[model samples]
Target: MLNKSEISFSFVFSIIVMAELICGSVESLSTYHYFTKPSILISLIFFFWKHAQHLDAKTKWLTLLALLFSLLGDVFLMFVNASANYFISGLLAFLLAHIMYVLVFLRKKKNSKKVLPFTALLLIYAATLFYFLKAGLGDLLIPVIVYMGIILLMAITAFLRQGNVTKNSFILVFLGALFFITSDSLLALNKFYEPLPFSNISIMLTYSIAQLFIVFGLLKQS
Candidate 1:
């Protein structure tokens, strides 16, 4: 494996390229977006490998799989303009990713009633979002509802980790989960509700931060 400094350099380079592709509106290369959009997840996966060498076996593999699925999700969504099928595929990929995350967080489960209250909080948020999104969802109503449930469960699991891991790990992972939810909520609203200014930049920025926080949190545990 490369040293941390080497990995950091490569990761930063990839992100800069991605930002240029997104923000600069470069149209020189048609295939650039294909590689650039998913580059963030690719780099983060490498970063995870470098830092998680001693991580618990279950959490290590599960988190890695989750990241991989998220990368697929990013790639599939890049072609949303071409076909609606791509968007569904991307949703499926992210659903799987969240499932993987839920599994990883569950490995260190602790019995705490405090986690129950969070379930109610998350449900309320999901319910309110669904109320607004239902009409526009059309045929996607069921799929979107299921996706909401999974991601909500994913967040609940992260909260459930509060008393189970290091404070640094718990706080970072929980924050990351919230950021992930926010990013997804933004994407859904933009696509299903109404367009938001700078939706591309806003969604990707939050998504990138979400993945970083989660990866770093797991590294802390390692």
Candidate 2:
């Protein structure tokens, strides 16, 4: 059981995470058209800072690297309006962040049991990418392909780690990653294809759900 101070810290961190989700949702919905990279980077930095003293050494380092890569990703996305290179840079940064997540999760689960399903998902994602490669997303093909590969690895690692973690925490993290993927996929589809009805709403909804699960999972583990 956690002491009063620890519980209080958890509550505060939860609030911050919740606030970030709310802001992210609002940004996505308003179509305010501004990049959310700065705010997201700030939130990640604060999240790591707030929990720095409490995290295990390995977790602390991994989390820090994750945030750093996320910040780079954010900056890369920001350049989307300016140059194609920026978008690629952002994708690469996010890929690195996903790799960092895999490392962190793998540390908790040393054994490898389930890998086939993950490979199938990656193959499917690759097929989807190939289908879209020449459809105005010509320059984005390589970066997006690499990003999806890393994300697939993270999902697999997260799923495997779930077996070793507490039930609630595992569910939270797994579901959170699912929601995050849903949000990103929607955004990508919107960018490459025609916009769907309620697209903004759908993106925001999934984004919030994803953040909620991730924050709660971390807090529970803490």
Candidate 3:
């Protein structure tokens, strides 16, 4: 269980992340990215670090590996507007992070009872998304297809843990996966389709919340 100190630190960090995101949403305060994004990543790392002593070596390593790639994804995407390569690199990093999360979730999966329903849900969501985005994704067709498959697989695996783990644990991770899907969908739509008003705020908020839910859920299992 998290001690008072850990809880306080996590709370403070979360607030900082929120403030940074809010500041970033406004025109003049965009410079806050330097502090906000890194702090968000660091908060996650610190949370895991504090709890690492309680986890198995393999679990510790895998979780940290996932977070590391996520940090890289954040950094790469920061420069996405400057170069297409940066966006591609960011996508690949996040894809690897999702793969790691899938592995982590599968390791914790103790029951197969819910797999079919989860698979069906993921398939329907992916199919609908692809249908809408396919026309605009001309050059990115193959990459987008592959990314969608991986993320959908991640979501399915997350839901499959429902009956296996504690209800709270399952719900947190499952919701994290769902928020991840929402965040990525909005991101793609904004970049490849049409820009939504305040897209930056929405994307960062959902993305931050998704990471926090997953991290806290895994930590709770400790």
Report the C-alpha lDDT of model 3 over 117-150, residue by residue, as the tens digit.
7788778878887777887887789998999989
Better of 1 and 2 by lDDT: 1
Judge candidate 1 at residue 199 and give its lDDT: 79
List lDDT for all candidates, in order.
Answer: 0.84, 0.65, 0.82
Winning model by lDDT: 1
What root-mean-square deviation over C-alphas does model 2 reach? 4.5
* Deviating ranges (above 4 Å) for candidate 1: 1-31
Instruction: Estimate the TM-score of every prediction.
Output: 0.89, 0.72, 0.92
Residues 1-222 of candidate 2: C-alpha lDDT, one tens digit per residue: 344645565576556544544554565542432444355456646755665676688876786687678677766765577987787787778777778777877766646546676667757875785575448567676677677667777777767765677777677777877786777778677777667677755765675456556545654554
Q: What is the TM-score (0 to 1) of candidate 1?
A: 0.89
Candidate 2: which stretches are off by over 4 Å?
A: 1-37, 110-115, 118-122, 125-134, 197-201
In model 3, residue pairs whose N, Cα or C atoms come closer than 3 Å (at least 3 residues apart or on different chains), thus clashing, are none
Per-residue lDDT of candidate 1, residues 20-87 (tens digit): 34642556655666767777888888878876878888889999999999999988998889999999
Worst 10 residues of 2 by lDDT: 29-38
The Cα RMSD of model 3 versus the native structure comes to: 1.9
Worst 10-residue lDDT window for candidate 3 reads: 1-10
